[model samples]
Target: MATYRPRVLIGNWKEDACLEEERLRDFMHKRERGELLIQKIDKLQDNLLKKIKLSVTKDGFVHFGDTVMLLNPDNKSSVENNPGECSRLTLAVNLDDISIHSAISLQAPCGVSATKSVEPMARNTFCILSVDGGAVDEPIRFGQNFCLGTTGGFSDQMLYLASDHKSFIRSAKKSYLQQVFLTDKLSYLTCWRATFLDPQLRLEYEGFPVPANSKIIITHCHTNRGLAVPGNFWVRSYFGKEYEVVCHTYLDSHRAEEDKNYWVIVTANPSNENGTMLDRPSPYPGETTKNEFHEET
Candidate 1:
């Protein structure tokens, strides 16, 4: 048998070994941080996913967990007595399993799931819930009651009065509620009245003539909270430049009362001309722009 010579170790084998060991350690440290961050985010998301439901009403009261809070006619100074409890009731929306935090900032990857692809979709539905009050707007307050009218996505666009069973009846006299209003292109104006007729709730939008083929959509409405009316109006100037105006109206029950109907107007004009200069058809004979107040039960 031939004798075998022992192999010699390469130069700087010790240095190479140390360098390799350092690289491995660095990778492990980074991995540990990443795991920890993921764990934190998971806990936070799980806690916020608990179900919270609200029953729509004309008085603007909503259920916060099991507690009922009023939106209108508020008298409470704080939503909750305990600061921690108040902090826990903050509202937030999560759409398509993506964290709001991640959606708002793309740099941070902590809350995103590895299996989920980051791509935009045509339509997305969001889940709304209460979370830590760190980022959301402070709960709206009226009197001593917490106003869920503008909170919890209960604005006019999502809620509306029932059209059947005479939920709303016209006032005795014709006034702003029956008048036709004019607005400039790129500008929006709206007004509304909210009334509760015992078991029924009524919401009336000030009437205006819309152009042919224009669309009318109710943006939000609530018997107990607020109302939102959004519609599109198309216009063509004397020079033939086409323009569009968007109008939105809201009536908050928590703020609206008998003889004090809620109203809001938005105006935007591409021509930069004063509102009076915009050409609009004259109001019908005997119609008045002034609002007529009436007492409601």
Candidate 2:
């Protein structure tokens, strides 16, 4: 680990290569949403994913590393080549473990093809990071997704999207991946969710003028809670009339009882700048229990 601490994430890193036609179908059904991120990397053909085997141990150990060769799923004498052998691969990582960074490459003559395939491409990944922690203004909801605080919170965060929606549409659509990190001392201080809205229509209603700021409330409803699962995780939400719901669930073997949580009617909005959030009333009494988020401010 570096002197500067990195974010720790809870996600799965698995191998989806060299699959039997029938078995591959099973795997597809397993991590449909997670496969969306993998598909983005599949198009890039990076060495990071080449020749890797991922597994979970009985003692609850999740490991991700590389292997040189894999037995052909259908045969013995035949060997399968990892796509990394001859491609410039770009990884679309969804996990945020500070200790987890990978590099995969073949030695000697095999690396030539991989080296040549490293064509530079314009790209950016959206990430959530803590921005301002010092004294600023009272914590206020900016648009719908972020909260501003003088103490610690997401301020001046950056949002990066593909240059064009046409290209993005062709790639992974409707894929939701969440990465969470916490410091040893500061275990759980903050929480956040991302929402989308029409960037052009500033104000859609008569008297309710949309704030010039980045976030606006598309609807008011309940907070969404998701189900907890190991390995690959996928949660669902509904952007119904007057509200957008995002159910967040954390996975822990010991915390099996903390499953299927809800954030019923979370606020939502649109983003002309990058992405957006919706707003809800403060002190949602009875609706929630702990209100750690309310206390953070």
Instruction: Give lDDT for model 2.
Output: 0.22
lDDT per residue for candidate 2 within 139-217, as digits (tens), equals: 2222322221110111322121111112332312122322221222211223232222222232333223122212212
In model 2, which runs have C-alpha deviations exceeding 4 angstroms? 1-93, 96-137, 142-170, 173-297
Write down the worst ten-residue block by lDDT for model 2: 66-75
Best by TM-score: 1
Stretches > 4 Å off in candidate 1: 1-20, 26-37, 50-142, 145-297
| Backbone clash tally (model 2) | 27
lDDT of 1 by residue, 208-259 (tens): 2211111122221222222211111112321122112111233336333321
Per-residue error for 295 in candidate 2, Å, reads: 29
